[model samples]
Target chain A: MSLDQSFVGRTYPPTAPYQVGREKIREFASAIGATDPAHHDPEAARALGHPDVVAPPTFPVVLTMAASRQLIEDPALGIDYSRVVHGDQRFAYTRPVVAGDELICVNTVEDITSRGGHEFLTTRTDVTTTAGEPVVAVWSKLVVRGEA
Target chain B: MELPTQTFQVTRADLVRYAGASGDFNPIHYSDRFATKVGLPGVIAHGMFTMALVGRAVTTWAGAPDAVVDYGVRFTRPVVVPDDDTGTEIVVSAVVREVTETGLTRLDITATCQGDKVLSQARATVRTAG
Candidate 1:
């Protein structure tokens, strides 16, 4: 089934504030097998001029991916999750994530296109601090395989 | 304006292990025949896996094992991994580019496979102690 074209350009509400914690960052790093000190030790981060532990550059994926659920689960969108495969992802950052930041993400369905038995959905997630500081914007594309 | 980088190869086994660990069992990453059938030159690494590696390079360089405040990436190109004894090598790198008055540090980052930019125009930020 094709995605609802009307949903294109629709923006969802900002997510609840997510506190960037030292432990969460550490867990994500460990989950990804990242063995970086800056992602685990505050002292090590501070020594490198950080106020506390810093998250890896891709940390915003957690926030954005969560925010994007609004689109995937939108009843009006008519997306078939079972047929979807991640086509691509990219992040444009204004800054690196750090512990002690309260961040929020706003999700938008940027575009939806269909071609040759495939549906392409593009979503964008904007990450910001509670104070409205821009952190990064994540754009992801998902391709839905043809119905067998 | 930035610290030196730590470079290393990310092998095919590493990609396979990452796929198992991440629960992203996409055949294009493991099955070479499936990968070739899909028109990719050969088996390719997951873009997220490479993105995770870039995150590793930045956090490790900052000296904090956990200090990432914000990070994002775009998959401009795919990393093709040919079945060979040495496998494909992905080199992740980053350098401090700017410092803001709010004590935020921005780093320009990249993840390359065989010198071709797989992830491009990447950036990340961290807060510094005043």
Candidate 2:
């Protein structure tokens, strides 16, 4: 199904708060093979001026990607999950995500276009703390391949 | 200025770990049968996993753990990982495109697997250590 251009600029409600945990950060760091001391030891992170273990730069995807499901599953959007492929991703951080922070996401449909028998949809997710502090902005583009 | 190149080994074990960590359990990244049925060469690495590795290169270059201010990439190609102990490798290299007086360093990044570019139009802006 073709994406409806009218959905561009549509914004979804803020997602439920996700509490960042030290073990989660450690697991993610380990998965990516990031050996930074700050990602594992709280003492090491505190020495580096962080209150707790610091998450790797790309760790926000754990939150944003799930939050984006609201948009992709929107009946009006009519996104066919089977035909979708990740096209691009971007992250702009105001500060590194730290363990013990509660983060929320607001998803917005930034743009939509069709090309070469495919439809491309870009969504921007603004991540912030529950207290209204901006943390990171994430953008993701999905390409839906047309059926032959 | 050109930064030193960094290489990362991506094994199937790594994919399993990343899938658990990132909550992306797409069978194409693990099940060869599913990947083949879906028209992929084989089990492929997650695009975000590659980007995370590249982020490591950026932060390592900045000499700080949390120095990245902005980063982006387009998935131009996939990094296919054959099921094996040795797995595959991704080489990440970057050149300083510009350094602003305000302490921002802009870099043009390239990430390749088997000498073919996997990420295109990749770039990062990082805050240099004082």
Candidate 3:
């Protein structure tokens, strides 16, 4: 079944605040083999003017992915998780993500299109600190393949 | 001018670690059975994993971990990782597209696995720190 085009431009409610942990940033950096000192050592990050360990550019995917569940699991949207493949991803930052910052995300359906028998759903997630400081805007396009 | 190339090795173990860290436990990334059932060649690295590697390369080139202000990529192909000791490799190369008066350096990046492009339209903007 094709996705409802009406979902486009729909913005979901803001997610609960998620505390960005220093160790989680370290773990994420280590997993990707990003050995930058600013990613793991608070002192190094401080040396560079960040308050604490700074997350790498793609780190917000951790939060936004969890936040996006609101759209993927929306019974009305009817996204077939098993048939979905990531099509595109992008992030534009207002500032680098740092540890100890409590973050929240609001996901919005940006676009929906069908091509070659597949539905492409583009979602944009606006990430901000609990205090309403904008952190980054993340966009992800997922392709829901049509059953053969 | 072209920037120095960065290389990263991807293994099944790396995928497992990434899945745990990113909270994206999609079976297609770690389970060969589920991957094949889903019509994939075999267990594949998460697209975000590859994107993170490319982000590392970008940050390395920028000389600061927090330099990146904007980054984007299209997943053009799967980076298949067979169960092995010496897994696959992703080679990242980039060119400086522009440097603005405000100290932002824009880059056009390319990421390849086994000489095949895995990401397309990859680009990043970094704050040029003194």
Candidate 4:
């Protein structure tokens, strides 16, 4: 099944808040082998002007990826999860995510196209605090391979 | 200007750790049987995991952990990981493509796994430390 082009430009409701935890950030950093003290130590992050341990730039994926489930699971979208492959990803940050921030994601379909027996869907997710402070904008492109 | 290259080791353990951390439990990144059933050679590394490593390279070059203002990448090839302890290696390198007057540095990044390009059009805009 192909992605619905009509869904392009449609913005979904904001997701439930996700609390950014210091231990989660530290675990993510450790998984990536990032040894930056600010990612692990609240003191180091505070020294760098952050209120608590700061997350790596890619940490937002943990939120946006899950948030995109809203779109991927939409019956109108008709996405075949088994055939979907991640094509591209991007993140633009106003500031690094610090521990304790309650973040929400609003996903919007940016584009949908078909080519070479594949359907491509691009979604942009705006991440913000519950107080409406924008934290980051994330874009992800998923390619659904046509049935063989 | 060319930035110093950074290489990251991607082991099966690392992928498992990343999968748990990122909440992406895709079997293609862990179970060889599932991956092969789905037409992959074997268990593969998560594309986001590779991007995370590249992000590490970018922030390290900028000399600040939180310097990246923007980052993006297109996955070109999967980094296939064997079941061995030494899964694979991704080498990340970048060149300063441009510098803005407002202290932003645009970088063109390249990430390779076993001499094959895994990511294309990888780039980052960073706020350089003044």
TM-scores for all candidates: the values are 0.64, 0.98, 0.99, 0.99
User: Tens-digit lDDT track for model 3 on B15-120?
Assistant: 9999999999999988999999989999999999999999999999999899999999999999999999988999999999999999999999999999999999
lDDT of 3 by residue, A24-68 (tens): 999999999989899999999999999999998999999999999
Candidate 3 - chain A - TM = 0.98
* Candidate 3 local Cα displacement, residue A31, angstroms: 0.5
Q: Tell me the lDDT of candidate 3.
A: 0.95
Global CA lDDT computed for model 1: 0.76
**Per-residue alpha-carbon lDDT of candidate 2 for residues B26-79, written as tens digits (9 for 90 to 100):** 999999999889888999999999999999999999998888999999999989
RMSD of each: 5.5, 0.8, 0.7, 0.7
Worst 10 residues of 3 chain A by lDDT: A1-10
**DockQ of every model listed?**
0.29, 0.90, 0.95, 0.92
CAPRI-style class, candidate 1 = acceptable
lDDT of 4 by residue, B14-110 (tens): 9999999999999999899999999999999999999999999999999999999999999999999888988899999999999999999999999
Q: What are the runs in model 2 whose C-alpha is more than 4 Å off?
A: none
lDDT per residue for candidate 1 within B1-130, as digits (tens), equals 6566566566678777766545566788889898777667888888887878777677666655444565656677788877776777777767778888887788898777777888766777765643
Tens-place lDDT per residue, model 1, A20-70, is 888877776666777657778888788777788877666677777667678
Fraction of native Cα contacts reproduced by each candidate: 0.48, 0.88, 0.97, 0.87
Candidate order (DockQ): 3, 4, 2, 1
Off by more than 4 A, model 1: A1-3, A9-31, A36-108, A112-120, A124-139, A143-148
